[model samples]
Target: MASVWAITLLGPARQRRSHNDDDHHTSKEEDIDLGPEPCIFTSTIPAWNCRNLERLASKTVSPLVFAHVRASTEGALADSNCHPFSRGALMWMHNGGIGGWKLGVKRRLVSDVGDRWFEAVGGSTDSEWAFALFLDSLERLGVDADDEVRQRDGFGHVVLRKAMLRAIERINGFIAALPAETREQGDVRCLLNFAVTDGKSVVCTRYVSSRTDEAASLFFSSGTSWKMQPSSETGKGAGKTQLGTGEYKMERRDRGADIVLVASEPLTFERDNWVTVPTNSVLTIHNQTVLIHPILDQYYNHTPSFLRSRGFAIAQGQTAEDRKAAITRENSAAALDGTAKEVAVA
Candidate 1:
C-alpha cells in the first residue's frame, strides 16, 4: 500500500497555555507568539511494528504531522528512503512511482535540479528525486527552497500546487520522450500521490499519468478527535496499551476537523470514518478546511462511470484478491489487443 497520513492543528497557542508556568499570562500574547512545531514520524516497518511508534503516538502530540508506510515498487528499504523527506522548515512525502524512472529519466530528473537541492538527496529513491524536482520547481518560481524570507513568508498553497503540477508534467514529458520500443516493453504510467507542508498548511494530491489506470490508494478521515473505541469482545482493552486490537473512530460533533488523517489504508477498520480521496484531486488543508480540487490534465477523465483498472498499482503490492483482479485485467487487455490486431488486418 502506498499510503500517506497527515494532521494539522489550527491553534497551537491555546494548546501551549496549559504548559505555561505563569498564571497571569495573556492569551493574546500567547496567540501572537504561536508557531507550529511540526515533525513527521515515519517507519518502513509495515505500520504495525516498531514499539517506538506506539510510544510516540500516545505521547508526542503536534499541531501537524505526516506519516507514511511504504510498499515500495521502485526504491530500496532503508531509513533514508523513508517518507516525509525534509529540507529546512519544509517536509514532503510521496506515495507513488515516477513512470519510467529507470528508463533514462532518472538522469534527466537529476540534471534538472540544482546542486543545492541535488546535494540534499541522501537516498537512491525516485521519491527523493521527485521531492528535489518540487524544490527546483519552487526555485524556478522565484521562491528559494532555502531562503529564510520565503520560509517566513510561507510558501502559499498556490506556489505549492503549481510546483507539484510541474513536477508531474516534467515526469510525464520525460516518459513521452522515451523511445517507443522502451515504452512498449515497460510501464509508462505514473501514480503520483504527493503530500507537502511548510509546517503551516498541508497540500496533497492523488493522481495518475495514464487516463485509464488507477493511481495508488489514498484515504482520509477527519473529525474532532481520533479515539480508541471499545472492543467488541469483552477481554480486549480500549486504549493505546491494546495496540492493534482496539478499534478507533472519528468523532464528528461539528463540521470542523481538529484532527485529520490520510493513509494508503485505513489505520483502523472504521469504514464510515474514512473517505476515498477522488482519484485525481488535490486535497488542501488550511485553517482546518479540507478542500479537494480535481487535477484537470490530458489524462483526466470526467466521466463518473469510468473505472481505472487497478492492475499496475496492485501489482506493486499484491494480496490474494489483488492477484485475482490483476489476472482479470491482464486477460481483458490481451483480448482487446488481439481484436484490434485482427481489425487492422481485415
Candidate 2:
C-alpha cells in the first residue's frame, strides 16, 4: 500500500538549498525558504534514497515537513507522478486511489476540473487529477489557486477543509453514477488518506470509501523527537556496517505533539508511540492541535467494532508482513463469529 509521512516543526526558521544544482536553474535557492512560511520537498525516489533529502533535512529544519512513498495501483511511476503536489502556496499529498478511475470515471473526473487546472495536469495519474479537482474547488469557492492575494490571505482552515470534502464528494458522485455492471467489475472502493498544508497549518485524513473493505493502512506517530533508538539495548543493527543505519523511535517527554509523523506503517517498532487513525476520519493538525472528524458517506460505517476486510488492500501490493497481519485479523474475526454462534445456541 502507499504511505505518507509528515513532520511539523513549530519553532524557528532554517536556511537550506536543493541538492540538484541543475534543477535549481529555474528557481533560486533563496526563493524556497520555510521561514514564517511553508516549503515542501517531494521525490519519486524511495524515501530511503535521494541524497538531497538527507542534505536538506539535516540543514533545513522547519516546524512543518511532509514526505510520501507511493505503491501505485492506479498511477504510473514517474518523477511527476510522485506525491506532494503544490500549486502556488498550497502543498498537497495523497496516499490512496479514486475508486473506478479506469472505468470511464477518468473522463468525468477530468471534465469537472477547470481548464487552467486541467492543463496543469502533467502525469497520467488519477491522484494528479484529484489535485486538479481540489484546485478547481478552491477556485470555484472564489479562492483562485494561482492568485497571490489568496495565497497571502491564506485559504484558511475552513476553505481548505470544505474544498477537500467537496473533492471527495465529487469522486463519490462519479462512482455512484457508473453503471452497475461497470461498478461490480471495477471494485470502486477508495482509500483516501490525504495531507494538505500551507506551510502554516496542516490537515490530513485517513478514509476509505467502502463499508465492508479496509482502506490502505495508515498509522500516525507524534512525539518531541524522532531519533535513532539505542541499538545496543534493542540488539538491532548494533554491528551494522553503517553508523546511522539503525531503527528509529518516537520519544515523547510530554503529551504535546511537537513533531507529528503519519505513515502507512510504523517507521519503527516502538508500538507505544504510534496510534491507528480510525477509518473514515480526518486528522487535522492546526497550530499543533490534532483534530479528527469522521467522513460520513454512503459507504461509511458507524458501528464501533465494525471491521473492514483488508484483502483488497493486500492484493493491491501491500507489504507481505502487512498482508499476513490482515490474514490474522480475518482469522480472529472468524473465531469471534464462531464463538457468538455457539453462545446463541447455548
Candidate 3:
C-alpha cells in the first residue's frame, strides 16, 4: 500500500462577493505540504519531529480540506507530482490507476487536450494529465477553466459536476480509442475515484469502467463535528489536547452535516458512522449538503442488487475486504485487467 501523504486546505474566504452572499465567507490558501516528504529540505519525513505535524494540524482551520495518500503507479516521487493540482480555481486529486497507460493511453490523453491545458501540466502522472483533461473539458463547455471571476464567484455546482462527468467520459473515450491489441497490453481497466472542487462546491466519484467490477475503495463520512475523544493515553503537554496518530470519530448531534470527509478508505474504525459512496456514482457537496447521483453510461449495470466483485479493488489494496457474494464469480465477474463478462441491462 502506498503511504498516505498529500493534503490541500482551503482557508476562510479573504474577500466577500455578492454572488456568494448566503453566508458570506471568503476563501484563501492556507498551509499545504503534500508528498511522503516535503521537497524543500535535504532530509526525509522521519527526520522531522512528530510535534511539527501536531502543531500544523492544530493551528490550521479550513472548511474545505483534501488529503491524499498515494502510491505512484505511473509517475516518479517528485513534489510536483503530489496531487490536488490546480489551475485558476479548480483543484483535483485522484486515486487508483489509469488502465493501459503504458500502451497508448498516455499519448492519446496528451494529444487529445488543447494547448492551454497541455501547457498547464507540470507533472508526469496520469492524475495530473487527467486534471489537464478536466481543464480542457471545462474550456470546451464554454466555461473558461482559468477565468478569475468564475474562480472567485464559485463555478456553480452543476457546471462542476457536469465537467467531472465529462472528464471521465473523455477518459473512457481515449481508452476505448486504443487498438484492440494495445488496449489489452497493460491493465486497461481503470479505477477512477476522483475528488475535485472549485473552492466552494466539491464533487467526488467512485467509478470503474466495467459494470461488473468494483472500483477502488471510496468511503465518505459526514457529521456535525469530527471531534477528538478524551484519550486514555496522555502526552507531555499539559492542558493541551494531543492529536493522536489514531484517535477520532464522527459525532452527529443532529441531521445537519457540518463536516464531511471523503477518503479512499475510512479515516477511522467507526464503521457505523461512515457510508460507502456507491460505485459509478457522483457525490456532490455544496453548502455542506451531500447529494449522490448515479453516472449512467454504457458500462453501467442496471441491477440495483448487483454485487460488484471486490477482488480487483482488494488486489490493489484499495479495500480491506472482498465483499463479493462468492469466490465462484471469478469467471462471471470482471477483472482489473479489463476482462469482463457481458453486463446485462434490465
User: Considering every candidate listed, which one attains the maximal lDDT?
Assistant: 3
Estimate the TM-score of every prediction: 0.78, 0.80, 0.79
The clash number for model 3 is: 4
Model 3 quality (TM-score): 0.79
Alpha-carbon RMSD, candidate 3? 8.9
For candidate 3, write residues 99-167 as lDDT tens digits. Answer: 878888889999989998899888798998988888888888899976667766678889988989999
| Best-to-worst TM-score order | 2, 3, 1
Candidate with the greatest TM-score versus the true structure: 2
In candidate 1, stretches whose alpha carbon ends up further than 4 angstroms from where it belongs are 1-47, 232-245, 318-346
Compared with the true structure, what per-residue lDDT tens digits does model 1 show for residues 1-346? 3333333333332342334446766343232433333445556666666776777677866677777766765667766777778776677888778877878788888987899989989988898899999999889888887876556456777888888888888888888888998888777787889998876778898898878777778888899988876544345553423335566788999988998887777777567788888888888877777788888888889899776666666765511224665566656765765742111100
For candidate 2, lDDT tens digit of each residue in 13-103? 4555645468655644554444333455656666676677777777765556777767655566666676767776677887777878889
Among all windows of 10 consecutive residues in model 2, the one with the lowest summed lDDT is 337-346
lDDT of each: 0.73, 0.71, 0.74
Please, what's the RMSD in Å of model 2?
A: 7.2
For candidate 1, the TM-score is: 0.78
Model 2: pairs clashing at backbone N, Cα or C within 3 Å: 1-318, 8-63, 8-64, 9-63, 9-64, 10-63, 38-199
